[model samples]
Target: MSSSEPRPESGPTVPSVLTWGTWAAVVLVAAQLVLGILMLSGSWSLIEAHAGLGYAGTLAAVLAAVSAVVWKRRGGSAGVMAHAVAMPVLMIIQIGLGSAGVKWVHVVLGVLILIGLIGLPMSLRSARRQSL
Candidate 1:
């Protein structure tokens, strides 16, 4: 390595588990939204798949929350940690709403959850860049 050449910086890398889990949750939530729209449009046959994905999305949210906690323990942002923790809680309520047959609230909450899930990764990346 020459002095004139740039050296690779070494520091904390963004948490892969958090990033991957958040994206997975985002995908699951988006798919659920689509399945939901279809069901609302009279395609009741997709209900089974939609319900299955909702459970998976909840699992993913919980995992992401765990990863966020780990990240915070390792000097991550408190706001990010809070956001991560909230995701799963929201998901649980969303699930309950769905189960209770409150279709409109469930749909609205699902959209909000999807937006949150999508924001998580972006926030992680921004924090990484700021730390660099």
Candidate 2:
């Protein structure tokens, strides 16, 4: 290799803009949780707001999962992709319970979804670093 010759390009220096999907999922889910808690505590209100945001998070999760799958096919990690898919599935169950007013299970699933949302992004970041 001579100084005048072009060198091969290095790997990604910046993360993908697709990360917004992960962040959107996390933020929407967190907001939904807060809304649910407020409704339960009888202080804050808006069941409709919670439901709407819950659905938004649900869609975001699916989108994020798709992004992860694409990323994985491109030689990224599966853990993050798995988590992205898992969260929405769990959230849907939570929503169903809430819709049917199956109190206890709905609350339980909400807790799990919150945990998943938090963990998914963290796992993704770690996996991305390892891939890099």
Per-residue lDDT tens digits for candidate 2, residues 31-82, read 8888888888895458899889989988888778777777767656666677
TM-scores for all predictions: 0.89, 0.82
Candidate 2: pairs in clash:
none
Deviation in Å, model 1, residue 60 alpha carbon: 1.0
Per residue, candidate 1 scores C-alpha lDDT tens digits across 1-132 of 775433356224558888888888999999999999999999999989999999998898899899888878867777888999999999999989999999999999999999988888889988777556
lDDT against the true structure, per candidate, is 0.87, 0.75
RMSD value for candidate 1: 3.8
Output the number of the lDDT-best candidate: 1
Which regions in candidate 2 have their CA more than 4 angstroms from the true location? 1-18, 43-45
